[model samples]
Structures are given as structure tokens and as C-alpha cells.
Target: MPIDHLNPPTGAMADNVIGFARALRKAGLPIGPGAAIDALAALQLIEIGKRADVYATLEAIFVKRHEHALIFHQAFDLFFRAEEDWKQMLDSVPLPDDARRKPPPASRRVQEAMAQPLKGEEREAPQEQEIKLSVSDREVLQKKDFAQMSAAEIAEVTRAIATMRLPQAELRTRRTRPDRQGVRLDLRRTLRASLRTGGDIVDIRRLGLIDKPAPIVALLDISGSMSEYTRLFLHFLHAITDARKRVSVFLFGTRLTNVTRALRARDPDEALASCTASVEDWAGGTRISASLHNFNKLWGRRVLGQGAIVLLISDGLEREADSQLAFEMDRLHRSCRKLIWLNPLLRFDGFEPKAQGIKMMLPHVDEFRPVHNLTSIDGLIKALSAPTSGHHGPLIRPAA
Candidate 1:
């Protein structure tokens, strides 16, 4: 395990350690200056030649969560792999061939972190060469698939999603509220107020139907094919939950698990971690029919009340596709104000509802929209704000 091939750190080891910590922070890890200082002090107790010792020491000080381990490992490898000066090594490192195959999210972030010059160090100027104009980073990010985004890009997208506000279109309820311009006259209130004037009414009191935001019920799929998109969708759900009071979140894979309380945590990371711990199946096989049946039988009446808008996030690749799935989908559609099916598979330009599950559930949904990127998510917000009639009416079939 000893890295005897590499020399021991020089007087500048402290700076190198601090720079590496900063890189990890930029890559969405929670490492800070204190952790960096602790790492440097810990390095003195163990022989730096032992790569295992160095890795453990840094990991213990830097990594705070299970998900962060990948980012830390990739960053450490790229940062400390050089036998020569670390700064020079970073400068000489070539970018991965993104055109051929996209790097994993963690690896891409590690590469971006390594490309940055450390504190007190200056990046060498590029040789004078012909330059070409390119699209803006934000534009490119908006179009990029959630699964293809790097850790840093994901963090940026999460921030953007958090700031996104849903439209304030309220639904009318049977309850009434006091309003001067109301159509219904309040005789009781008018009579009570006229007591001071000895039955002489001064003003006419009126009441109007109370309005509240339509409740949102998200039924998210967590099967193997949907693992990547589900994580991002959960972040979106967290933001929605924080913004509104009547939001319910449920995760389904082999079974249905209600995660509304878990996702209510203020911190996105903590909320997601809590959800992971509570759900037995994170990236398991799909049993869409069974899960939908469970939801319709048990939770349908409870969460799908008061003009709820159900957001079904899934690929519709059900392992147990049957007549029951269609039955449950129809039941769910009737119970909610709107049943919007958000499918990540729709990102494919030539996508068709050929899958058994997709075909069965397609007719029940009020609208079908892609949920693979930020732009698609924005489109969903617009669709919810201004729902159209016959957007995807019956008789629409998948291409054969």
C-alpha cells in the first residue's frame, strides 16, 4: 500500500493539502479550512509513503457523507498521482475525451477541480492561437441531461431548481371567506353590524369562495433505470415541498414508500439521506403495477384529495405490467385534478410509448412531458400553470 514510488512532501505540502481541500469543496464536498488543517496535522503522525495511510487520513478529515466518497476518491487520485510537483502535474494533465464517452459525474468534477490553479499560484497563459466562439456555459448546462452533469454542474442545477417558483394559480374551495367584491351577500354579518345603528344597515357584507394552492402529489420511481433521474427529481421535490404546504412525495420501486416527512428536512442532503435510509429499495427492480395498486388502495384517498396534481415521475418500464396497472392509473387519474406523467425516456427525440407499462398508463394521464433536464422541468411548470384541453387525448398510440 505504500507509495514509495513518489517522494515525500516538501515545505509546500501544507499549501498543496489546502489546495486539494478547496478542490473537493468546489466539487460539492463539505471540506473546509479546519478539515484541511486537521488533514495536514494528521499526515505528520503517519508515513506519507504509505498511500493507504494518506488516503485514510484525508478521508477521515474530509468526507462527511457516503455519497461524497466517490468525489473525494477521484479528486485525491488526480491531485496526488504526480511524482513531481503537484501544480506542474495538474497543468500538464490532459482533459478527458468527452466526445467519445462522458466521464462519470465525480470524475468530471475532479478534472475541473484539478484544472484550477492553487492559491498563490498563477496559471500559465495559453499560447496565442486561433479562437472560435462557443455557446455560453449556462446555455449548455440547460440542455445537458441531468445524468450527464458533473457534480459541480449538478450543484449549480440544484441551486437553480431551488429558486424556481411554481405558478400561484389557486383552486376554488367550498369554504367561504370575507370579501368586499364577493357575489354572495352575508346577511348575518350585515345584521350583526347594524345593531349599533338600531337596525340601520350602513354597508352590505359579502363572502366569496376560499381559494388554496392545488396540492402536489409526486409518485417517483426508483428502479434501476430511473436511479439517476430520481435523485435530481427528489431535489426538485424538496424545493417544491419547502415552497408549499400541501406537497406529498412517494417513492416506488418494488413497493411504495411514503417519503413526505423525510423530504421535509430543510437541508437537501439531509433530506435525501433520510429518504435513502427509510426506503428499503433504492435502485431495485420495478413493480409498477403492484406499487400503483398499493398507492391507489391505501394512499389514494388521503394524499390525492383537495384538487391534487399528481406528478408521476417514471420510465414506465414495469416488470409486472398487467391490466391492474391500467386500472390503478385510471383510478389515480380520476382522484386528482391533473395527472401529469413526467417521463425521462421522452428526452429521446424518437421516443414512443411502446412499452407495455407506458401503453397501459398513457391513456389515463392528462398530459405527458419530458423531465430529463432543467428546460423540461420549466416546461412542466408552464404546463401546470396553463393546462390545455385535449393535450394528449385518447386515440394517441405509440409508433409501431
Candidate 2:
């Protein structure tokens, strides 16, 4: 039956629909009230052949928050798609499969060569070969470490991260309204009562907008130890930035440089190239305490005004891991919403936070996680979607 034509609908129809939309939002689609209305309107356009049609509308309306896109994508497949029992059936399909000609291997098209046969059995000319631009196989290889990677693999990982979008990096905030159950004021209603207090003279008004912005700041280390990973981290920072306007990004090693401007460049290659030129201390010694002291004192007030989540990306093998490092690390921990330290060292199968530098930094971080591979980046998305658990990592540093 058509939903609109199904008689006087149940009194709770709107409530149930709202609840389902909220679940989709929690799963990662950026659905708000307007989109919910759009979803309901879509139901009218589609035939109510089954629940799948209803679900398809909801999924179509809410699947754009890139990070949660994958989850919603998976949920739509698993939830909306009809489940089927399977029995193994084997059959060999015939030669019609070869009807699809083989793609010319690396632009070595036999047809093109035939079209321009060799002159006097000598090669006519080395024609411009087309670069087949696709990323499936290359993306698979980046799940391994760079130190263990071949040169070609390294180049491929760079290109992939330059293009990957980080989903669920958007912040969530709470808002207050008078009709909300947890609202703090009844002033308008109370003022009506206060008219009786002053001989029926209404003498009061109370209303306010309550909001909490997700305070977030990042301190990325660009030390010699972090050279490889830091370059990749910049890509993540850039993706986060294009999604949100006010994110803060800083690069540190021997000194602190606010490369927010450098990162904002539209081209990832240009952005990283500009950042490299702007930084004087690239692949230099780590002076963690000094760089952070500058951040805590100079830029903290401007960026950390809101309860910002601080992301510290580094290997934590500080050149100077002294009382000063402890002091600065402690100061930084106290000034942010959540302090997450993403150590590439954590990628090792057998790792521990046992190094003196890591031991010092670890106790202060609210969470510790790896940030080296595509799988690790995906995990970061999930962690950002909800919250992190079992946050621990090994002490292994990247092999030189």
C-alpha cells in the first residue's frame, strides 16, 4: 500500500522516521532535518514494493559524509540487499569470455603497431605511450611499510594518499533550544507567572543559545625520525582542512611552523612542496620540548580557545627528552579536549611504549594509535566515528 494512502498513519510515524534518520547519521551520513524531510518525500516517488525501496531512499539522502560513507555503504549493502542461501555450483563458461580482447599490455598495443608497421624492419619511432591512470593495485601495496617498500611502491603510496579522502573527520557539537528536554530555561513561561508576582505585570525574559565547538589542534613532527610518515600525515591534514574551515595545522621539528597556509593549497603536490620550502629544519634533529613550548605559549591561546582535540604525530624519539619535554607535554595535555598521539612506530607487530621518549610522551596522551598504513588510516576513521578503545602501541621505530 502507498505509505501516504495507508489511512490515518500511526501517531508515531514521524518519531520512528526521525529515529531511523538519527541512526543513519550515527552510522556516518551527514543527515539533518531537511534531508530527513527529503527522504520522506522520496518515499512517495518510489513504489513501496518492499522495505528495500524505503531503505534506498534513506541511504540516498544521507550517504555523503565521506568518512562514514564507507560504513553507510556497507550497511546499505548488508541491510537493504535481500539475503540469499548459497550452494556451490561450478561450471566452466566457454570461449565467449575471450570475446573481450585483452587490454594492450602497457600501451604495447599490437593493433597500433600493425597500423604503423616498422620501416625496413627498423623501429619507425618511439611513440608517446599513454600512462594508464588507475590505483587499485597501488593502493593495496601501501598497507605495508615504506622502509620495506620498493621505490615504485613509495611513489604510488604518495599519489594515493594525495588523493584519499578521510571520512568521519567532521566534528560533532551539541546545541540547545527552549523546547529541548534538557533545556535550562522556562523564563518565558515563568515570566507569564511573574505577571502575577507584580500584579499581573510580566517583568522577565530568558533565552540563550548553547553550543560547544569541537576544539581541535594538531602538532605534527617533521623530524628525521618522522620524515616519511610526516609527509603522509600532511595529506591527512589537508583532507581534514578541506572539510572544515577552522582546523589548525602546525609542523614541528627543531622549531614550530604554522604551515596552515601551506597546507591549504588546493594541489597536494604544491602544498607539500611549499611546506618543504617553508620549513628550514626538514629531516633534522627532534627538539620536541622546545617546539611544543613555543606552541603552548604562542599559538595555544588563539587555537585552543575551544576544547580542541590535539593530534600529536611523531615517533617520540626526542633528541632532548628531559624535564623540559615532560613539562611541555604535561602543559599541552592539560590544554586540549583530547590529546591523541599517532606514532608510526606503532606499526610494528611487536611494539611497546618502552622507549624513554615514548614512555614520557605516552603517559600524557589521552590515546595512542598507529598512522602508517591504509588499514591504519581506516581504523583512524572508525576511531574518529565513535571513540577509541584498547589504544596501545609498540616502541619500534622505523628501520633506517
Candidate 3:
């Protein structure tokens, strides 16, 4: 493709594409000035009047990831249109009852983006008004359930989550390093120091066990029951992965899928897009036993070493009562130094181990905590940071 079309005429079509690009950027696609220019050039190669050709041209130029496709489509429909079509849309025409149908409303982000003033235009400021506030907006959001949050709120939470960092909780290894005040004596190092002193004096060298941050292995459930929570948790995991190189991530629904490399991308949006593309069983039925079995047999030995911490994020609602679920859970617990079960269902005050999977797996987890809101996630961070003895002992639930 000869991109010589860059010198296209600055016609009304050019203006429309520029305005459309602005709307897309506001709606969260990474549209820059160069992208807008490229879009214009690509449009010059296609039939301007044909909507399909125009859409394809602009989409190819602007849409970098799969998740942005919906936002792009919505913005394109609302931004690009003929005056007559807009007039017809504004002034509704009467139609037979059966023929009349309501169109799906645009997403809040797209609506707000399109409502913004175009280039060289001024936006009217809101009138000042006195209002009394109790709690701040963020305070309320911290406790709000992920499933109940609005798109705008979710965006804010995602940004907040990006800033959150995991504490560098280190574990001592068998390997030792020379230390000035270490308890254990290093005879070899001490003898070497004596030789350097020509046996006149001996400088005793002490050794201490090497300490490094524990690796994190997250197995997230992407089943229908966990779709909302897992999506938000993935953003949190992305932050963890960015800060720590030893983090490994896996997504499980009907099967186990390793997404560690995909999440290693620096950009959170791009990382999530790659994850969505790699998984074919998103929002499907949960097969906890089978998924856990596969994970233990394949990835357990690889990622569970070096005193790694395992995060099991799921509702624990298995589709089938597989007898292997308990065995797999135990195997996983044994492989990892700490196994933390993060269940969104724990947000409920009356939550109990009623589900077969929950009951079977609960006993193996070192900690069972809620993962439904930001506060809960903060609690998880604290729990991981605080030092505790190995194997807190199996949990015995009250009989139903």
C-alpha cells in the first residue's frame, strides 16, 4: 500500500475524520495526532461516500486492540453521518407498532466523548452551586462492588488499581551471602581474609541466607459466575505483574490457559486485549476440578517453586461435583508456600461454604478473603505483607 495518499486534500471529509478521532480518544482508544493523520490518508484511498469503506479505513488506522472495537463502532456511528440522516434521527418519523424498535443506547463514555466541544469550540462551564458532602467519591468507590460499578466508576477504579503496588515480601533461601554481622560463620571467607593479612590477623566473615521477593502465581477463573470480578482482578494483576517480574498469571474457565507472557506487556490495555484474544472459553461454565488438575499436572512444578504465593480467584461454584477437586486443591496447596483463595462471594455477610467446591477447597487455602471491592483488595495486600508461619492448619467449617 502506497501511503503517498498522505497529501490528500483538506476537505470536509478530512474535518469529519479529525473530529471522529477526537471522539475516539475521549472514549479511551489511544488515538494520537499521527493516527488521525494516517486515518485521513487511508480514507483518501477509499470511496468517501461509502460508509463501509470509510469505517474499515478508519478502523484499521485507529483500532489497535479488540476491546476498543466496540467503542470505535459506537463513536463512528454517532460521529459520522449525513445531515438528512441526523435530521431524521432527531425528528422521529411515525411507523407501525411492529416496525418501530428502540436502538441500543450508546455507552456513557462514548456519549460523553461525542458531547465534548470540537476543535476551536468552547465548552460552557457549569454554574457554581453550594453542596454539602459527607464522604468523598473515592471513599464510596473503594467499598462499592465491582459488579455494581458504572463504566465511569470502573475506569476510575482501574486507574487507581494501576497505581496500587504490591509489597516486596521476601523469603529467605538456603543460599547464603557474606554479611558483616551474620550469625553463621563463613570459614572459607574468614581463611581467605587471614591469607590477605599474611596470618598476622584474621578477619571473621559471616554469612546470611539470601532473601528475595516471593513469586506470585495467580489462577483466575473467567467463568460466567466470575466474569465481572475476574475482569477487574486482571487489571490488579497487571499492576502486580508490571511491578514484579516473577509474577505468573493463568485464566481458567472450562480449561486452564496460561497468560503470564501476555500480561507481561507494559500497557495494561494492550495486555488485557492480548489475554482476551488468547482465551476462547471466557465467560463459560466452570470446571474447577479439571482446570486445577491440568494446572497442577502442567504449571504447578514450574511456577510453584521458590516459595511462590498462589492466588486462586474464583467463586468456587463448580459446574460438576468432580471428586478430584479436593485432591487437586490439596496438591496445589502443597506445591505453593501460601495459597490464598479470593472469592467475590465472600462479600456477602452470610457467606458460608455451601457449594461443594468451596467446601472442598476452603480447607486447603491459607486465607479465604473477599475480592469484590477495592477495600478487599487492599486487605489482600496487607495479608500478603504481614509475616506468618507456614500452614496455618486446615480450616474446619461448621456443619450445615
Candidate 4:
């Protein structure tokens, strides 16, 4: 039987759908009123009491991305449960161990959204309470690890990263452009000027070497352990990519995938979505050595020219031999003007170079830094802005 025949389009059911949509929107799904209306219409075409039918109906209308399916189901399970179940849960009634069924864990954003009062609902105002923040919320967020952040906090941080501007790490190129006080004399222009003056008087035109922002090539690890930090770092890279045209981004897990073009989109969310769709090995096993070898073999000379700076963002965990990793790291370091290693593992208080991969790759990087938080990113901008002239020696600054 159709849902309309059994569960008709009641006002209560409509309200429930709208409220559920609100909860999902809060949980980071891009749900709007139109989606809720569509979901309700879809529900009318299916049997409502059958959980699978209802879920499919709503999911077809609401869930657009593969990654959001988990959030949708978690919210669905919590919102569509029996009223008695909610009462039991809210009232702190404990079920007997024999009767209890443990559900899979939900993301923090979903839990927080479910706890909040639904929009446009009238409720009594709570009693006032005093709250003090010695350090501002933004300040605290700057130092918080990306792995430890809640979904809402990640959203906030992503926005902050999108607004960040990369300092122009200028490089003096051989290519010249017209400048008033340029040192190089333009003989052709000087000759043209002499002809205009009937060969009696000559004027000299000077050209200055173009000062362009150094190209940035980022190789980010997407292994399971580095996924959280990498996802956030990609937001930062997106910001830089949009600001500058020369930035190239690559994601590596079991292999290397160039996402330079993907991140060139003006919208950060759209760019990241494109990147996620293009990458097949996200949050998969690590093969640091193989990925680096692939990068060095194919993309080394192409993107590494014009004094490019290479940012290797990884935990330096390799499942293969360290010998190959060391060779590739050396090749990459030699190709780029500056090679900075941004390791999230450096955030640990007692981090040591015990891992063979870490030890082998350490000697090749000009700078070793933490990239687990916003403050570390700020430090990176400072480091990049500093002068890079006559600096050929290996400089390894330990994490603070």
C-alpha cells in the first residue's frame, strides 16, 4: 500500500520532516527547506512504516554525497525513533545489559544538533549564567589540533583558512619587463627612440627582471592517520591556490594524484568536493616511498622550476623500505628552492625520529615543522616570507 493510503500527509508528519532537515543542516549537510519539501513528497510515494522504504525516499531527496550518508543515517535513527525511546533516553533510564543493543558511534556534529531545540519552536528562556573565556575562542581554536576538532569547529577553521592570504615569496626571474629605474638597458627601444629623434640624440630604456611569487608545489598524504589534518590543510592550500595562479597541489596515499587543477575553483567547498571526487585512495594505506618516487619521476622538473617551494605534508610513515624514501626525498629537495616538511605527528609532546621513514626523510628537508593547527600554519607563513637568498645548507629546526 502507498504511504498516502496508510500514513497520509499529516501536518505532524510534515513538521517532523522539516525538523529532521534542520537537524541534518546543523550536522553539516547542505539541506534546505526545498529538500525537506521534496523528501516529504517522496515519502508519500513509498510505504512509510517500512524503515527501508522511508530511508530510501528521504535519502534520495537529501543525501547527495557519499561521505554524508553516515551523518544522514545517524540523524535518521535518532530522530525517527519511538517517542518512548526518546523519553527513556532523555530521562536517563538505563536498559538491562541483556536487552541493550549498542548502536554505532555518530559524529559529534550530529549529536550536538540532535541535542539542540528545533528552530521556530517556542520555549521558556533559560536562567542566566556567567561564563568567562580567559583566552578567546578563536585563540583556543588556533592551537587546537585538527584531529581533535568537532565538525562545527572544523567548519569555522575552514572558513578562517579560506580567508588567509599567502605572503608573496618573490623570486627574481630572468624575464624582464619595462621599469623606469631598471638596470638592464633595452637596446631595441633605445634604437627606436634614436630614429624618432632623427639619430641626433639617443634615449636609453631599461627593463627590470620580473619579481614573481615563487611557485608552490604541495604533496599531501591522504593515508588513514594523516587524513584529518590533510583535509584541513587542503582548505589552506585552496585559499593559496585561489590567491595565486602558480600553486600546485597533489594528494598521495598509495599513489600520487595531482589536484592542482581541482583546487583552482573559486569556492573552497566546491574545490574540495572536486578534489575528493577525483581522489580514489583517500584515508587508505600509506606508501610514502612509492608516492614520492612517482612524483619525482613524473612531476619533478615540470612544476619544480622557477625556484618553486615544495611543501611535503605527511606523517612520514612508510610501509616500504626507507632506502627508496631517502633517495626520492633527496631528489625532491634538490629540485625545489625550499623544501618544508609539515608533519602533524610533530604536535606530540614526546615525538622522536624513531620511525625509519621519518629518520630517512629528515635530512632532506630544509625546515621541519608542525602542521596540526592554525598557529603552526601562521608560523609557516612567517617562515616562507623570510629571505631565501644564499641559503643552500640544510636547516632542520625542531618543532616547538
Q: Which one is best on lDDT?
A: 4
* Residue pairs in clash, model 2: 67-167, 67-168, 195-200, 215-308, 215-309, 216-308, 351-394, 352-394, 352-395
Per-model tally of clashing residue pairs: 0, 9, 0, 0
In terms of TM-score, which candidate is stronger, 1 or 2? 1
Q: What lDDT does each candidate get?
A: 0.77, 0.62, 0.76, 0.78
Over the stretch 263-355, how does candidate 2's per-residue lDDT look in tens digits? Answer: 887645456777888899999988888999999999988997655778899988986778888888888877776787888887877787677
Which tens-of-lDDT digit does each residue in 1-400 have in candidate 3? 6766468548555666677788788677898999988877776677655656666777789989866766776676666443233333233333333212322322556776786655443533211110111135767888899999987678778878988887664667778888987889998888878887887556789998776778889999999889899988889999987768899999999988999998887657667878878999999888889999999999888998878889999989986766688899989999888888888887887877888878888878887888999999898888777663454534423211
The runs of at least 3 residues in candidate 4 whose Cα sits more than 4 Å from the true structure, single-residue gaps closed, are 1-135, 195-203, 387-394
- Looking at candidate 3, the ten consecutive residues that score lowest on lDDT are 125-134
Candidate of highest TM-score: 3
lDDT of 4 by residue, 8-73 (tens): 355667667777888888777899877877777777776555665666678788889866766776
Backbone collision tally, model 2:
9
What does the lDDT read for residue 219 in candidate 1?
94
What lDDT score is found at residue 223 in candidate 2? 81
Better of 1 and 4 by lDDT: 4
